[model samples]
Target chain A: MKVKIKSNAFLIAVSAVILGLLAGGLLMMSIGSNPFEGFYYLFRGGLMNMERIGNTISTAITLMLVGLSVAFAFKTGLFNIGAAGQMLVGGLCATLVAHYVFIPRPFYLVVIIFCAFLGGALWGVIPGILKAKFNVHEVVATIMMNWIAYWSIYYFVPAYLKGPSLETESKSIAIGQTLRSPWLTGIFGGGYINLGIFVAIAAVFVIKYVLDKTTLGFELKAVGSNRFCAEYAGIKVNRNVVISMMIAGGLAGLAGMAYYTGYSRNIQIGVMPSMGFDGIAVALLGASNPIGVLFSALFFGMLQSGKGFMNAMTEVPPEIADTIIATIIYFTATSVLFSRFWDSVGRRKRDKAQQKSDQDESKEEVSHE
Target chain B: MNNTTTKQSLFTSPLGIAIYIVVGLVLLAVMATNHLIGMILPYAIAYTIPLLMTALGGLYSERSGVTNLGLEGLMLVGYFASALTINLTEQTLQASALPLGLLAGVLAGALFSMLHAFASINLKADQVISGTAINMLASALTVYLARTIAGSGNVRIMLGIVRRDIPGLSKIPGIGTLFFTQSYWSTWVALIVWGASWFLLYKTSFGLRLRACGEHPSAVASAGVNVYGMRYFGVGMSGALAGLGGSIILITYSGEFNGTVAGLGFLSIAALIFGQWKPLGILGATFFFGTATTIANVSQVIPQLGVIPPVIFKVFPYVVTLLALIVFSKRSAAPKAVGEAF
Candidate 1:
């Protein structure tokens, strides 16, 4: 059973990659870009050299965090469109802690990340509490909260934390606090890849552990699978729902830290990055699994990082990347229907084999008689 | 039988009076904040009217069981198209083109929203994903088209429609001056849409059929109603109204097009949900948000409170929106079949 489940997961991952590639190819064709050249450049631009590879991996780290946040919600049957909002809030909070909160060197790093996580979790909890207690749709709640987050970040960053100058941004955090890849420099010859990537990897393991090996995970899975059953079984399903949302929100917030502190080198947030929302697509494509999220995030990161190369290599507008991503998302949204169709086909084949075996046994009995 | 009845009654929900109370208190608070109240209140009213108009459109689609999530995208197209049409036609008429623009907005928005309806109703695509496509398509297409038509990303309405001043009400000492004076055709359109929607949703057989299609399409189909047609009608109406809202926004708020539609369409969705999918409730939500948003933007006028930074005040509306969403989602009962497709 374990082997079968593992193989099925593998198949789904492979199919998702193929679907993404095919969709990208079709988009390139529509835009008159040569697929081969486009893809070649995509690879070359994102991973051709150590520096390029490091940048891609750094981006993937953040993407993976947000992607996992989205997947966590999906696992619990909540569509968290507020990953963007949560990330913004998280970024804001992480910035506050890193800049204002006094702490030691490496310990401060963990504290700031935690602060980001808490900020995101708080934002997420608003929507979760609504959904759990009031039966409000998280979709609408999250969307609205995103605007609040925008204004909050806008006001807080510019007004309260403005440096000695009148600049809209805050004072830059000390260089010691910002994430860098000192450890990975030995391996990749001083690339941009940082400890954040390791954090991302560690997150995947933790999510897997919490989900597959814990009682809390069991309760969450039960509630997600069917609220009525969980409720009837005397579980506080609504609480678990809220908890799941908090976890999801926290993960997304960490994504913001990975993005702002690690990659952008600034604590200030202006526009809601598409990364938060794109995580939804990534989560969906990964089928809401932690390991799947890791790969899907990498894939999406590579695509984004490769857009410049793709544009240069072909007449295909770089905008084709967005079109392809959107198209793949469209397909992924319908994946539930596809899975249903596939399952029915499998069931039918099994039924036919069972009937044949029964007939064969009856004939053997008659021959024996 | 008595025991069973009691058990059933325990499950039966209470009326959502708390929503009204919270909404009322929030409005009163906005009104009470004297320094910032003047700017925020009018802005909120102006913004709310159009958004409420769009939410009515959403109410129709959702009540009919197909979620029109592409509303934001459709509104963007509506906004740009209305701007272009008004600008182009006004060149010939010089002034009457504003009303003409509203008409054009409705038509263009209807046309765009049909694409969303077709994808969901015909292709059976997930409504959320379909909405996302429409949104992206609208965003990209609007930017491209607006640039092409206006010869720039920004299109200035040469002679924009001025807000009509109500003589008696505009003279009212303080609050009346803001709410009643110099309102756009959108305010009238919003009221009319609200009335017409109320009538259509509750009084007409078509609305009943639409609701049936949304809640239980299979049953409605068995009852001899065309589920697809009803859903299309609901969604199409939603698109047209959202378009009108978008156009109104372009003409009144920004006086031009600069992707200023921002995320109002999505906000309208929030209003729809916050309003609990009811026309009256949606109106209140629209007004509430519009007021809060307007107050946040204009509260910078008072130098004393200005020290607090206007952004903090700007957070009020969103906080309320979040509160309302939490309050409503948990308590208010949605239409029996809100997101389910017919």
Candidate 2:
């Protein structure tokens, strides 16, 4: 019964996704575009070419990092919408250190990544501190902080990177500091996908392990589940809130470096990436689980990758993918309702098992008595 | 004992005059810098009025405990609806189109916000998630609609509304250039909206009920006030203001709607927080932020600052916003039940 219900829940979610895609496809068709051709190209274009696959991988890596960031905050029952702002500062910090810090290529990469982590972490701390010390809401604090980070990087990057004349971005990284894949350089002729993707994957694993197996994770989960209960149990709720935000910030920061150092060299600080906010959708779709996030991130990466194909092969615009993605996210946000449906099925199964066992046990107890 | 305790308490209070000191320093810095003081200040004040109006809109929603994360998306819809309506009408009625367009924009904004109200208040969905979905929906819908109308992603008003030059105030000194020189209709709307909002929020029974709903919806509902209705009103009000802000950008600044309306929504959110959710506080916050942004945009005009890297000045608003939020986070008071749906 329980398994049946679980399958039913899964089916509902799957159907919702299919419905969203169909709606998007129909919308495209109504505008005189061939949906079939567009989808075929989306898959073909993104994965068909080695170079395109590399780009998709790079994008997936960044999205995963941001997704993880949002997931971490969600685990602690905090919504950190400031990931975009943190990423900007983190990317800026990493670039600054990479430009100024004179070191060997490999060593420079390590230091820059660290700088990104700290930069993002520091950005996160502002909201953490606010929520901890004051009764201020994390949502408002983080949202506001994102704008501040945007302006700060805008001013800092241009002023210091260039002496003062150019409106364009700062110069590229030093030859030693330009992020390059050693294996790709050795074999495939300068591929952009680096070991940073592995780093992101490893970070996901470590976070999953910590959340599932550690005391700190348990404490955080307890607080998230019920702050009143955790408070009664003598846990320091404020400390947990602060720490969760810091971790969330650090993950987003790393995502920035993974994108900049691994793929794009220049940092564009003026616009909010919308990537950070997209992380919220990914995290929701993934159910805030690490494994779920990986799959969800890949799905998003594929949609993004397929966009170019759809544009080239058919009349459908690449933005149709965005609408589909949003639809998926909307359905996933309501997953709680689906889960509740499964719970009822499980309850009936438990009741049947208890009745049978109790009847047999009661007969034996009567005989013994 | 009572006197000493009272004195100590006053010194330690979060709302102490120390906040005034920080605000003063920011103003002083703007004044002391030649380019910032002389050139950018006026543009900031002018530009800020629209955002201030939007923030007030958010204030109404948030004060009722529903976060309007869909603000950006809603604002976009508001802009396109208003712009398209105004543009279509301008051919028949040239000068009279402006007021008609704004009214149409407000109505459109209210309609757009109702969708959010339906999902969040009526369906009992998570507020933040519903808001996010609304934003995504808005972005796609606006792009598709605008593209259909204008052929490209861009939507230009061939004959947009003209600016009005204030009669006596137009002749004032250095300050007059920003406000009086080709003032858009949106600017007047902003001032009127701010005054009207202040009265609505602080001086009326409706405002009291809205605040009560935000703080404790269950109690408010128990007292016979319709909590859901108040929430719908709050969300609708924010949508209206944000919609006005979006149209103002098109009609006054760009005279068209494009994809460039990116950070303004977030900036307005920051402005609201920086303002400490107070009318007077918002005025100061919006003015400061507005000036910072205008400086970034027009610093190239100032030969002195033009010597520095332009991108730095351009992103200065985000930096200032970050710094201000960090500092303000330690001090500011938001609505009591901000993120909670009820």
Candidate 3:
């Protein structure tokens, strides 16, 4: 029964992906473009060479972490819409540590990473507390927090971390201060890939372990499924809510570290990270599972990285590519409908089997008579 | 003695004369300090109208039990539709293009919101996810279509209407300066809509059933009203108002569609919450937020307010919104069955 349920989830996810792709194809055809060629270039652009592959992985690194953050919050029945705010604060903190704290490379990196986690956790906990104590809708509070973080960065970057000419972003961090280790870069043949990819992979396993093998995970899942039932089972629902948000915030913060330090090497002002919201699509497509998130993030990473190349190759504009991605997200968001359809199919098959068994029993009884 | 007694009673009432006195004094101080304050007030009013209209839209949807977080997206779709219509028909429709464009916007917004209603009501999808998807689709589709059709990513309309004074009303003292002068016609339309919304929501039988559905769908269903239909109606109304709000902004303020609404839709949701889903409360909240936003833009004209960083002025409204949500949310009684699938 358990295996059947697991397979059902897998089937639903696969079908959703296929349907989403079909929709995207239809959209392409509507725009008078060859969907097949568009997809071909899209894949080629993402995996044409080692350098491109490394860039794709680099892009996936942030996505994987953010996806995990969102999936983790889902496990606890909390919608962490404040991931963008958390990312901003996290990236800002890491940037600050990277600039001021000059120590041994390993120690500085560890300190900076920890600071990023704490910053994200701090931003996340505000909404958690508001939800727990004040009954404030986390959605509204988190959205408000996003704007606050956005403007705060706008204020902070120009005043303290202003680059030489660009007023919109901070000065780039030196290589030693960044997450880009020489060894990793060397293996990627001078690609943009960095140590953050490894961190993201490790996070997937760590999150999986924590969720599957811990009492805390059990309690959080219980609360998510039914808060009243969890409370009746002697779980502290409010504390779990706060703890889940903090952990989710911490994961997103790590993503911020990867993005600002590893990929871009600088923090930008006024722009909320689109990856924060895209993480929702990733989480949904992955069915909110850590391992699933890893694969889905890789897929999305390919789409995003390949979009520019696809635009260059085909008459299809970049905006159309965005529409395609949004279409996929729209389909994935309605995954509940797909599950219901699958459930009905399963039920129908079971009903047919039961009827066949009954007919065979009746025939045997008549033969004995 | 009788006159003093009457004055004392007025002061002691909850809607007290003292409150008006305080407001009057603050206005007097602002006008005395900077005459530009009077000029900014009209702009604030103009800005507040769209927000107020959008909030009213949110009120209808939420009251009927479906959370319409796609207001921002709906607004964008409406804005794009209206802008395109106006831009294409400018040569033929001329001055008549404004009303025709608005009608197109309302229809487009309603049609777009039907996608949301279908997913949330029939498919029983997560409302927030559905809303987010709508937002993504709106921005992406609008930009894509705009690029393909217009050969540019923005749709610019040529029908820039001149602001008209309301004849004798514009000559009144401080009131005329703050309310009547330099106001767009859309402002009056928005006010009329707000009054109509108040009447419909409070005085109509349909409103009672809609509110009941939000609070308890089973009870509403038991009473022989279609819960799903009511939800659809609520969401459709929200979309129409949001569309009108978007059209108003394009016609009166921006004079173009840019595939974005600057998060005004979300701000309207904030206003809805701040107002506790009441029409009058929404009006007051919109004005407060409108004033807050206008201050950020008008700071350049008021030299005395220019010293503080412009970012602070920009951030102030958001900060105030956050604070307001935190303080009022606990006391605010939202519909019990909101965000739940019927």
Candidate 4:
């Protein structure tokens, strides 16, 4: 029973991925393209060469951090829908620091990253306080925060950080100010992949260690599993909620730093990064597990990066790729339902086997008597 | 002495009195400052109609125990369906085809919402996740279909142009100019729907059962009511209303269906919470939000307000929404079992 329960989430995630791909294939077929060939081109687009592979990892860096943010919050039974808002604030802060702060390269990098994390944490903390103190729904609060962040960026970017010609985005950061180290770029054969990947990887290990080995993680998980029960067990539920959200926000803030300073290198106005929402999908697909999130983020990264190639190689439109991604997310979101269904089937089989064994034992006892 | 005591009681009940006084002051200020504010009133009402309908739709779903965050997506689907219908039938049926287009949009919205219903209801999936999926799917599918059918990512409805006045109503002194002049017939439809929704939710047996399901599904189930059925009904009604709202926006306001519905759906949800899940409260919330939005749009054209940053005006409505939520959220009474699987 223990083993089955342990593997349940993994099984559901794997099946969801398969189902998502199959659905995508069906969609490809409907568009009059061969599914196999379409998938082939998609994979080729993401992994055709060293440059492509590096690009895929580069894309995954932000997703990885965002995914971790979501998964961490999920463990504490909080839905941080405001990750996008958090990312925006984090990115904005990092952008400000990157443009204005003059220091040694290492110190500047540290200061910018720290500021980004604090910005995201601030965004996360508000919703947390609202939820903990007032019992206001986090979902609604986070969504509201998202718009607030969006409009703030919209106002701040054009007013202060206007680029050369575009009124919609901020000025690009200098290369020396970015998270891109020359050694890392050189290792990836001159790909855009940067130090953000290392940060994401480091985050995964830290999060895993904290979740699996620390009392704080246990307490948070306990609160998540049953708030009332956790309270009865002397856990400060409100504190845990606030802490969980702060950590989650911090992770998302780092994602913003990675994206604005490392990936895109500038913030755009009038647009919320879709990566924030995509993180939810990544977390769901990963079953909210750190290791699972890492793998799923990479998979999603491939699909996103490979999509352009698929569009170019096939007669299929670019929108189909988005549709496919949405379909995958839809399937992943329903994985809990599938997991429950699978568990019931397993339970029924176990019950039948136990009944048969008991009958055989009863018959042998009667014969011995 | 009795009249004075009554006035004192009104003062004690500050919120109601405060709202009236603030509204009066704002109106007086607007009249003194610019006549353009008066012109924006009709436009504000037009904008409010869609939001009002969408919030009403959200109330139905949430009151029936399903957390429907997909109101925006449902609205978009409705918008796309109506726009596509209008586009396809414009040459043959001309202006007369709009009703059909509206019906198509409602049907499409209801049909799309079924996916959400199935996931959150039968599958007992996480309601938020299911709603998010619906949103993602709706945008992606609509954009894909629009591109395929129209050879572009946007669907433009060209046949039904709504810019007219109601015959006798447009002649009324101040009221006519604010409410009837240059209004879409959809405005009247929205008002009628609002009245009908109030009656259905507050005065009907089905509404009682639906609300019961949201609050205490097990209790309703013990009373031999099908909890699932009532939830489905609530979700279905929500879809229908959202669909209508989407159609109204397309025909009256935007005239084009893009892959997005701005953020009106999210704003409606904010209004839903702000209104404390009540019909009358929702109406007030929508009006306030609509006016704020109208002010934002009008600020760009008004020379005096031009001195202020344009982005501040654009951000004004959202900021107000956040403040409203923060103020009202704690006191607002939501259905107890919202986001819970039956």
Q: Write the per-residue lDDT of candidate 3 for residues A1-369, one digit (tens) a residue.
A: 000123456777787778767877777788899999888888888899888898899989999999999888888888777788899999999998989999988788789889999999898888888888867777778888888888889888989999998888899998888888888888777777988898899999999998999999999888888889999999999999899989999999988999998888898887889888878777877878999999989988888888888889997667655565566667666767777788899889999999999999999999999
- Runs with alpha carbons beyond 4 Å of true place in candidate 2: A1-16, A49-51, A96-109, A155-167, A173-179, A182-191, A336-369, B1-19, B25-42, B86-93, B166-182, B198-207, B295-335
After superposing candidate 3 on the true structure, give the runs of residues whose Cα lies further than 4 Å from its correct spot: A1-7, A351-369, B1-34
Candidate with best DockQ? 4
Question: How far is A274's C-alpha from truth in model 4 (Å)?
Answer: 0.5
Of 2 and 4, the candidate ahead on DockQ is 4
Pairs of colliding residues, candidate 1 = A134-B329, A134-B330, A135-B329, A135-B330, A136-B329, B40-B294, B40-B295, B44-B290, B44-B291, B64-B214
lDDT of 3 by residue, B1-342 (tens): 133443454456543444445446645645677777776787788789889988999999999899988998899998999999999998997999998988898899899999889988987778887887788788888887887777788899989767888888989997786677777877887899899889888899988898898999999999899999999999998999899889988998899898898788988998998777778988998998788788788876777677767788787777767666765665565788887889
What's candidate 2's DockQ score?
A: 0.29
**Candidate 2 CA-lDDT value:** 0.74
**DockQ of each candidate relative to the true complex:** 0.32, 0.29, 0.47, 0.48
**Comparing 1 and 2 by lDDT, which wins?**
1
For residue B328, model 4's alpha carbon misses the true position, in angstroms, by 2.5
Query: What is the docking quality class of candidate 1?
Result: acceptable
Candidate topping lDDT: 4
- CAPRI quality of model 2: acceptable
A-chain TM-score of every model: 0.86, 0.85, 0.92, 0.91
Lowest summed lDDT over 10 consecutive residues: which window, candidate 2 chain A?
Answer: A1-10
